[model samples]
Target: MTETEVLAVAGQQAIWACLMVGGPLLGLLLAVGVVVAILQALTQVQEAALAFVPKMVVLGLALMFGGPMAMSVLRTFTEDIFAQMVSVGGLR
Candidate 1:
């Protein structure tokens, strides 16, 4: 493949990997936000901390739980990129 083609593929893979790695955390936080919003509306709780704390808690939990898997995926992508870079003759 041409240089441009290889770079394009690498870029696409990087984006995909990022989405895949972050998608779960993003989705979880979104769901939590929606639920928290609804509860606040029902209870008439106007405290900003109410909306913020749960997200922080969830984010901590997600990273605690998902950190290893995310790291593995990122490592794989990085390794693949480096390996390809070497195969391509090392940065011209």
Candidate 2:
């Protein structure tokens, strides 16, 4: 592969790893935010904590439960990059 191809593959892997790590937490946060917004609208009592607290809780829970998966994704990405580097080095 050319230098540009190697760079492109690395970039794509980085993006994929990021999405894999963050997608679940972001999705949960979005859902919680929407629910909080609707509830606040219905009750007409807007407290910042109402929104902030749930998101914080969800974020914490997500990280706790998803930490291993996230780590795995990062580890796999790192390994892949290293393997690619080895292959590229052999080309030199």
- Clashes by residue pair, model 1: none
Task: Give the C-alpha miss distance for residue 1 in model 2, angstroms.
Answer: 1.6
> How much is the lDDT of residue 23 in candidate 2?
93
lDDT of 2 by residue, 1-92 (tens): 98689989999999999999989889999999999999999999889999999999999999999999999999999999998898888755
Score residue 72 of candidate 1 by CA lDDT.
92
lDDT of 1 by residue, 14-89 (tens): 9989998999999999999999999999999989999999999999999999999999999999998898777676
* Range of the 10 consecutive residues with the lowest summed lDDT in candidate 2: 83-92
C-alpha root-mean-square deviation, candidate 2: 1.6
Worst 10 residues of 1 by lDDT: 83-92
